[model samples]
Target: MPRRQHITVFAILALFAFIGTSFVLMFRSQPQGADYPGPTSQEPVLVDNEILLGTATAPKLENETLKAELGNAAWKVLHTTMAKFPDKPTEEDSQALKSYIHLFARLYPCGECARHFQQILAKFPPQVATRSTAAAWACHVHNEVNKSLKKDLFDCSKIGDFYDCGCADDGPVKGKEKEKEKDGFKQLELEKEG
Candidate 1:
């Protein structure tokens, strides 16, 4: 392994470790709040910097386009992550993906969207047992979300071809496994500790 590559991998791992720990502590310390059940167009948000045991309030969206764009971008990254998940993930790998899915629900900038995802997750936990299952799972949940919003549904059968990472196009890229994609890597909290 090259020295620079090793260092980068080490750094990303460390970052995830730190974020995961913070999330655990935060979860333990969340203050009591009103219970909100079911889907809502607007949801409570964790204030910036206060996410480590923060309050949930409805964040005002300046416009409709912003919300749509954010949700679209987040879904793209999430679907792509599922597409690239290992064919047969180990316990740790599966846990990482699972944790990321939940963490994403918390960190999603749109409070209501986050709440909706959390509700969706409760109904359909992340299926990270294998690549095909995980991808299909993502598509199903996304369709559920679409149904809730009265949006067009996507066909799961074509998801694999729709979100190819292109990593396989030129054969396997060595060291690619350690390299973090932008998707949810930036928000990798709730990690599974070994």
Candidate 2:
């Protein structure tokens, strides 16, 4: 076999080894036996009539670098999601967004950070009535986290400018469509008169 072929084979083997190890570590890390279910008997915590996962403790993520990277990525995902939410959401849509925030806090990788977020959720309780309110709520909660971490607070009013999400602007579409429909009707009336 050529040297390049040998190198390719070695790389393939290394990749497979890495993937296998990752699977093993992931499964091994799961909580064993009875503790896996987490909080069976106690009543679930609730805020705004939404059920919350109880404050079960998790081992703190001690690696500061990894924690910071995770925090940045998570915040981007969260802010963008809120930014794209429907302008006038249904009750179910509102509830789903509220539930997702609670779940995200409950399952956040940094255990100590997750607990802090849970406390924030309990106090703030996700304002999901509309896109503007939901996005504002997310900004406010992010500011709360920033405050707790002694970081510079973000100006909530300028949140949309910061998290653009690069999606097309949907804010004015409904009003524009209504105007077009009214003009279309007027054109039809003129045609019938002729």
Candidate 3:
């Protein structure tokens, strides 16, 4: 194979390995709450009126259209991340996820939205022990936001179907493989025609 082809194959193999490792980590059951530091255990968040007033250090993005777009995209990322969380995560993984969530709320672009998210986090706290719990928690929190916004609530039971990341046991590229094979056949036909 050409150098480029070799590199592509290697990259695909590496991706498969990483995904496989994630699956293994997710399935390996750890004791419930063995390593998770719940909100009560974590350092207290100082109540800042600036954050509540939408005037914190994070820039206030007030564009309504942009805010909606950002909110939708952020929700997608959150749901997918929770969906992929390990079934039995290590203490480190659990802590990292919880930390990431708090930071994500703090750093969200729209100051108003961030404040709302902070309140939500304060109320819900992240459920990071198992993948199912994490995903369900995400869905519940999302519904809470939707309820506040007067938006239609999503079916939490169908969350797995909605946020399917294609990280199935079979592989991520089954459909891609078929498409690539078809494209290769088309390229061969074109070459013959030429």
Candidate 4:
């Protein structure tokens, strides 16, 4: 009887060990965050000094032709907002941008529109890029949106894809616009981290 008891105890211990090992292996194999290609090294990418200017300028999206030409569904949201705001810029416009950003940051949140805005901001002058209170507000929005969207969601993978930068088509070119794109990408990455 004693030998039988010892064997039973050993079997239980082995079972527990097998379960724990399996759990550890599964956790380690999972991918972290969005699949966007991040900087390989620990060193931070240098921000464009020229793009660090005061306030980001409001992008021109008013012309009917430009509005009609926008290809992305997300750009349409921005265009609709521009159409509603027209000539007079308000605190609401800034708030709207912020709200969109926050929503885009969420795992399953709609990111198409917010990504488009980031691309547009990448074209602004440094002073305008850094100083725009509106842009700062939008960043806050992006953060908030992410938080709100993750509350009830189970699958984080879907959300990551929705917000991932690799999904965006905007690429950096070899000129001033490229500099702006870099800054914009950095800003989005920072926002995601926060």
Q: In the order shown, what is each candidate's alpha-carbon RMSD?
A: 19.2, 15.5, 20.7, 20.2
User: Any runs in candidate 4 off by more than 4 Å, and if so which?
Assistant: 34-194
Model 3 gets an lDDT of 0.73
Quote the positional error of residue 121 for candidate 2 in Å. Answer: 0.9
Tens digits of per-residue lDDT, candidate 1, 37-143, equal 54565865443433422332446456779999988898899999987888678988997787777777767788777777778887887787777677778888899
lDDT pick, better of 1 and 4: 1
* Candidate 4 lDDT over residue span 1-194, tens digit each: 69999999999999999999999999787778737776778867653433332233344445555443542444335323322331234555444444443333221122343344344434421111221223333334434433544633323222222333331334535678656645553443222211
Candidate 2 has which clashing residue pairs, if any?
none
Q: Which residue runs does candidate 3 get wrong by more than 4 Å?
A: 1-56, 169-194
| Candidates sorted by TM-score, best first | 2, 3, 1, 4
Q: In candidate 1, list every pair of residues with a backbone clash.
A: 43-112
Looking at model 2, report the run of 10 residues with the lowest lDDT sum.
185-194
lDDT of 2 by residue, 1-194 (tens): 99999999999999999999999999998867736574457866445534456663556999999999999999999999987887689988988887788888877889999999998887778888766677778888898999998999976766655666344454544577756633432332101100
Model 4 TM-score (2 dp)? 0.24
Best candidate (score: lDDT): 2
Candidate topping TM-score: 2
* lDDT at 12, model 4: 100
